[model samples]
Target chain A: MKIEVIVFGMIADIIGKQKIEVNNCSDTTSLQIKLTHDYPKLCQQKFVMAVYKKVITGNTNLNNGDVVAILPPFAGG
Target chain B: MLTSKEISRYERHIQLPEIGIKGQELIKKASVLVIGAGGLGCSALQYLTAMGVGVIGIVDFDKISETNLQRQVLYNANEIGKYKVEVAVQKLSRQNPAIKFITYCTQLTNKNAIEIIKNYDIIVDGTDNFATRYIINDACWIANKPLVFGAIHKFEGQLTVFNYKKDNNTIPLNYRDMFPTSPAVAEVPNCSDLGVIGVLPGIIGTLQATEVLKIITGIGTVLAGKLLFMNSLDMEFYTFEITPDVNRKNISIEEYLSYDYGQFCISESQNQINEISCKELKELLLNNRNTLQLIDIRDQEELPKVPVLEELLIPLVEVIERVSEFDSSKKIILICKSGIRSKLAIQMLQKKFGLRNLFSLEGGITEWLKN
Candidate 1:
């Protein structure tokens, strides 16, 4: 299954792009591992993951063409 | 009863059926306290004033900088050295003469937050730090006032209303519900370092002001249980529902008072290492403590260097690899631009080398420069 990942805020800066497509990722954990493996800098930052606009935690299952977002809380005014 | 002059001045607002005579009157009677007169406060104050909010308070201790002119629309080049709230009051008063403006030139602390916020009907958090945001949210919860929250980062912005009550028994979700605890400071880069588009705060702040107006007039759905996220890069808006956290309930004032917001937000291991303030660091530096070893963990590009203190430069990213250079026997002090990176560096060093003599400079060089 392929998942479409959208990154926002500082996470986008670290990832070097707003959107990316990852292959063979079936759940939030696998996708997180795949992302951290590809971009080591992501491990240093804190972010929240949302699937289909709903924030999810732990090993939530992901389906084909699922849209995932990596959002870091913005502290700026 | 509005005078003919007042009626004509608010004619556009009066013309709208949703905010006609009664709504305008309610707006005129509403009291709002806006914390931080920076980017968000500048826009929030303007709209709130234009909408005829009877009483508005501005709290900020910062003086205007030339950089602030790009986004803090309330200040101009001439006002660079002036206090933010003083200048904001001058600008907002001219924008709407009928509204009363109160200025607080001091930073809001646990000692003064609840007392000052208790008098206002609504609290608008225009602050840029998590510690302050948590303080404001906790204060609002204790005071039972609705809070209008706004935040911006780069091209993205977020807005939400917390603790808005429909009745006595119903408890709404708050900042803690969305973020149980403040993110570690190193994980969150401030606008000063990361940079924000000048108009991001303007848009978010105006939205916050709009939420306040809606709450006052009882005309629209408040963002009480939802978080609105907008990305200007794509102009995509998303709202996510937030549920109340049972563990965050029944917070007492004593807990808020005892909470080390600064330490909690910046350092993950508060008890593991010693933390020194800028003043203490300065004193140690002045005393020429031979046993003290200062290491600046900030990137070389970070500005406002400590010219007065002699320190070794080792960026946080390089700390793990360069751990062999430090002497664990010496009292090690880590410094960074905002003190956050240094704390992270200390944690890294402690974990990698088992060095227990590490200490992070609280507030970093930014606080050092101020002193």
Candidate 2:
């Protein structure tokens, strides 16, 4: 399955891309592993995953063409 | 008892059914303290003053710099080098002479946070650092004050209200509920380093002011248990539910007093790496130590690169991938512009490969260059 991932804040700097297309990501866990493997820098960052405007955790299945947002907490005033 | 001048000034606000004369009176009776007079505080303070918030307190120890003119609209070129709260209070007082402005030109420390916050009805956190944010959140929690939180980075911003009291039986989620701990220093750089769009904070801070007004007048639902995420680049806004952590213990004032906020937020464990002063590093370099591996974790574009210090250039983002290339037997010394990223790099490497021979150059290359 193909999924569109949108990265925000510092994560985009680490990934070097604001939007990315990934293939063969079936669940949130697998997608997380694949992202960390592809971009090793993301493993050290703390962010939450949201699918279709809802935050999800732990093995949430993803459909083809789903949009996933990776949002890291912003500390600036 | 509204004077004809006050009535005309707040005609738009008084015209609303939700915020009639009673709500305006409530606003006039409320007291709010804004912790920082930077980007977020600039907008929040402006709207709060214009909305007739009675007693507004501005707390900031920083001065206006050249770079602050971009987003901090409160200060102008003429006010450069002047204290932030002093200038902010001056400008806000002129804009709304009916409102009272209190200024705290000193930093909010653990000893003073609780006492200072207890005097206000609401606390607004406009600080850019995690240590101060945590301190303000903990202080608000202890004082039982509702906290209006706002943060911005790059093109994105977040806003939420914490510790807001709704009923006698329920407790709202605080900052710790959403983020149990601060992100690694390398993960979240300050606006000075990463850069933020000038208008992003204005939007978020306005929303923060709106939330504060809603809470003060009891007119609408506040963002007490929800986190609002916004991206100025795409103009996307999303609010997600934040559940309070049941396992999280209530922080006592004693614990907050003794907490090492700076060390805890920057580096979770100080024992992860040895810290060597710049003078000591100079001696080691002068001694012709071949076993010392100096790693520069700063971005390639960082200025004043040390030509004399023989080191490997591994930017912070690529440190983990290139960690294996370093010899485990050599004494590794990580250096960045301000020593923050270097410490984060040391913590990352230590957690992954258990590298014991790691040391972060204290004060980084900037200090080393001074020597």
In the range B108-164, model 1's lDDT, one tens digit per residue, is 877789989998999999998877898898989888899999999888998999989
TM-scores, all models, native as reference: 0.81, 0.80
Write down the C-alpha DockQ for each prediction.
0.63, 0.58
Q: Candidate 2, which CAPRI tier?
A: medium
Residue pairs with backbone overlap in model 2 = none
Highest-DockQ candidate:
1
Error of 1 at B84 (Å): 0.9
lDDT of all predictions: 0.83, 0.84
True contacts kept of each: 0.65, 0.66
Best by TM-score: 1
Q: Which parts of model 2 have CA positions greater than 4 angstroms off?
A: A57-59, A63-66, B167-171, B263-297, B301-371
Runs off by more than 4 Å, candidate 1: A57-59, B167-171, B246-250, B263-296, B300-313, B316-371
- List, residue by residue over A1-77, the lDDT tens digit for candidate 2: 89999888778888987889999999888899999999986887888787876655445899999998887777898
As a TM-score, model 2 comes out at: 0.80
